[model samples]
Target chain A: MRNLWLFLSKYNAFFFFIIFFSISIVLFVRNNSFQRASVLNSSNQIVGKAYETTNYLKSYLNLAVVNDSLAAENARLRGEMKSAFYSDSIVKREIVDTIQHQQYSYIVGEVVNNSIHHKDNTITINRGRKHGIKKGMGVISPTGVVGLVLNVSDNYSTVQSLLHSDTRISACIKENNAFGSLTWGEENYDPMVALLKDIPNHVKVTKGQHIITSGYSTRFPKGIAIGRVRRTGVKGGESFLNIEVQLSTDFSTLQYVYVVNNLLAAEQEQVEAIQPAK
Target chain B: MIRIIINNLIRFVVLVFIQVFLLKNIGYYNLATPFLYILFVLLLPFETPNILLFVLSFLLGLTIDTFYDTLGINAAATCVLAFVRIIFINLTVQRQGLETEPEPKLGIMGFRWFFFYTLILTLFHHLTLFLLETFTFSDIKYTLIRVVLSSIFTIVLVLLSEFIFFRKKER
Candidate 1:
């Protein structure tokens, strides 16, 4: 017993290291999993508050750029307004029915902290549970798709940015509607680029073609702009095309974003979960 | 002793803030990110208990991870760094020679020794961090690029900070 105690005491540092390392690995694995919200993330109250404070101070430096983007968005929105369009058709019918139900809503949020460098980048937004933010909800910028909410606290949330290695958004080519999953951190490490995989080689892929969300998932609405195709190629013995895309949202300048709240998500999930008898 | 504790505490806070707020946003083409927080762990007093060193390293890593939104990756890497630190110090730094210099500061350890130490430790930390982050051998080449680039970035920043801040040993 004495020898055992002595042995343990002798190697106590190694034991301690093992313990700490195991704890860290456990935390890493647990938190990195999908849809699981852990307390150690940036969404924690104190950490979130600290980031919020610093972001508030730092936000002033990017005011001009933010204003420019906001102005551009406003102009785009203005052009889509009814007043901006000239009615050429004389025949007009006012048929208002309850056929179209609200499927999605947007909750505006300011990005408190964001990164594109790391293999799995994340963004922290100022809005959270109190502002209708939740895990698995889709987030979008004024320009295009941004990310999906991974965790949400009382007043803050962490978004799994599109640049994350695990992030896969169902996207389709606008020209031919050849749907595939969009992913980052694969072959290319560039923040401005991503890969569109699972696209069959038979599809006609051209440079500069637009890629938008397929709306196959409940997270995002259909037809949200994702990116533009930079190039496409089929690797030897591979059935899928190796297509590169230039992301529309400038993640470096990301400030304001909208957290999509799918009102019909619960219903969709419920319907999808219904098992058919074999 | 109290002075040492207070100084290290201040350093901990300052390093964490600088790393997360200032250096976090500065990366070259999503490749190199300078993790200045590891300096706190590397600069701990030589006489610090091995257990305490590991604990402090883990805490420092966890704090940085909280802000970076990488829950345990930094912590895991820093733990490995702390372990390596113990082994490296045991192998390189003689026990009896500790009277002249209390800690492994750039000013006390001189340029060559400190440079090698920082380079080796930073490389180990970055390699572990990037490997664990990607968790796949498929992108080994890209990950290596990131590891080397980030290690250089971190080593340069660490050396620069050590030179600027730490004073020469007062004989």
Candidate 2:
């Protein structure tokens, strides 16, 4: 018994290492699973507050660029206002359109923490559950699609950026309606580029063609710009064309984004659940 | 003894803040990222208990992870680094040397020894970090590039910080 005890004491450091190493590995594996919400994330109060304070300090550095983008977006929005169009009908009649119902709403959120270097990048925003931001909600900047909300606390949320390896957004080529999915962290590690997969070789894809959201899922509205096709190639024995896209939203300078609130999300999910399990 | 504890505690907070706030924003072309927090682990006193060393390293990693939103990756890498540190110190630093130098610092250990130590430890840490982060061999080439580039970046920053802060103490 003494010999056994002495032997165990001699190797206690190795055991401690094994125990701690395994705990870290466990945490890593659990974090990879989609549904599990972790408390040790950036949305925690202290970390979020620290990021918020730092973001406030850094926000001033990009004021000119942010102002320019805001001005451009304001101009585009103003051009679409009812006041910009003139009624051409000889007999003008007021018609109340009752056919269309709003399905998506936008909640403005300021990005406090953003990263593009890692294999799976995450962005932290100021809006959270207190502001109606929830998991799986789509987030987009003024220019293009951003990411999906992965976790939410009272005053902050973390977004799984489109740069993440596992993130896939349903997208289509604007020119030919070639349906495919946009993903990142593939062959090219460039933050500005992503891979558009499942596009059939038969589809006529051209360089500089616009890629937009297909609206197949409830996360985003249809026709939101995603990127421009940079190149297209076909690997041997593969039926799908390897399409490279240059993302529109420059994540390195992302300062603000809008979290999409799908009003009919619950209804759509309830209806989709009616399908029998295969 | 209390002074040592206080110094390390202050270092822990300062390093974590610098890592997540300052260095986090500085990455070159999504290739080179400088992780300066591991300096805390590398500079721990030579006489620190092995168990305490592992615990401190894990905590430092977890703290950085909370801010970075990468839960276990940094923790795992730092744990590996701590283990490597123990073995390296045992092999290179003699028992008699511990009496003269209380810890491994650039000023205390000389430039060449400290540089090699930082280079090897940083390489191991980055390799484990990026490998576990990508978690696949499919894009091994890109992962390798990130590891090599990030290691160099981290080494340069570590050496620079060492010279800037610890150079005066040597004089």
- Backbone clash pairs for candidate 1 read none
Q: Give the TM-score, chain B only, in order for the candidates.
A: 0.98, 0.96
lDDT tens string, model 1, B1-171?
899999999999999989988999888976788888899988998899988998899998888887877778999999999988888888899899887788799989998889988988998999989998888898788889989999999998999999888787889
Off by over 4 Å in 1: A34-37, A88-97
lDDT of 1 by residue, A105-152 (tens): 999999988888777889999998898788899999989999999888
Residues B74-158 of candidate 2 have per-residue lDDT tens digits of 9999999998898888889989878778879988888999998999999999999999988889888888999999999999999
lDDT of 2: 0.91
Q: What TM-score fits each model?
A: 0.94, 0.96
Candidate 2: lDDT of A271? 91
Q: What DockQ would you assign to candidate 2?
A: 0.77
DockQ of each: 0.76, 0.77
